[model samples]
Target: MIDGLVGGRLYGEAQIRTGQNGKRFVTCKVRATTNDGDTIFVNVIAFDDEVQTALLALSDADSVALSGALTPKVWTDKNGLIKPAVDMVAHKVLVGYRGES
Candidate 1:
């Protein structure tokens, strides 16, 4: 799992994109805060079509809970640099509005 948060806070938006080959993918960057107020950034990705559509419907600043596995992807960039990416394969998703608690 890629079940962590990214950005500067717990709230953020997920981005969905379709490749030229018609492959769909969803990415979410969330900001996770530690108990001490420290923050970490995480990037989550969903490749399943159904999950992608669901994630795409989520708007910015929405609160979402996701469960998934972690996957590492590596590729070479056009500048001849190797890039490594870690993503999540979301299996469960819960969407909630702000202050829903």
Candidate 2:
């Protein structure tokens, strides 16, 4: 039931890594600015090959729009420190090119 505006510049390029099952996983960070002038950062992960490919093509300044659920993850680091994190499970992605209305 998590929903909100999720779109912004690619803070960094998408990185592909191998998962436990040997499948490829892609992850990236986005910097979004809200109407209230609040800037927020979000991490996005894509499991689908096509989606992953599309995400990787985006440059650092590229704009993208996505709609999806926000899921929080909690874990303990090797040093036994507890960490909490959150990311978006994108259902749609729209690439914005320069000068495009």
TM-score of each: 0.58, 0.74
Native-to-model Cα distance after best TM-score fit, residue 76 in candidate 1, in Å? 19
Q: What value does the lDDT take at residue 8 in candidate 2?
A: 86
Q: In model 2, what are the clashing residue pairs, if there are any?
A: none
lDDT of 1 by residue, 1-101 (tens): 34443223234677768879988777876555556775444467778776676667777655566667766666567999776544556766666544555
State each model's C-alpha RMSD to the native.
Answer: 6.2, 4.9
State in Å the error of residue 87, model 1.
3.8
Question: What overall lDDT goes with each candidate model?
Answer: 0.62, 0.78
Give candidate 2's TM-score: 0.74
How does model 1 fare in lDDT? 0.62
Error of 2 at 90 (Å): 1.9
What candidate 2 gets wrong by more than 4 Å, as runs, is: 1-5, 72-86, 97-101
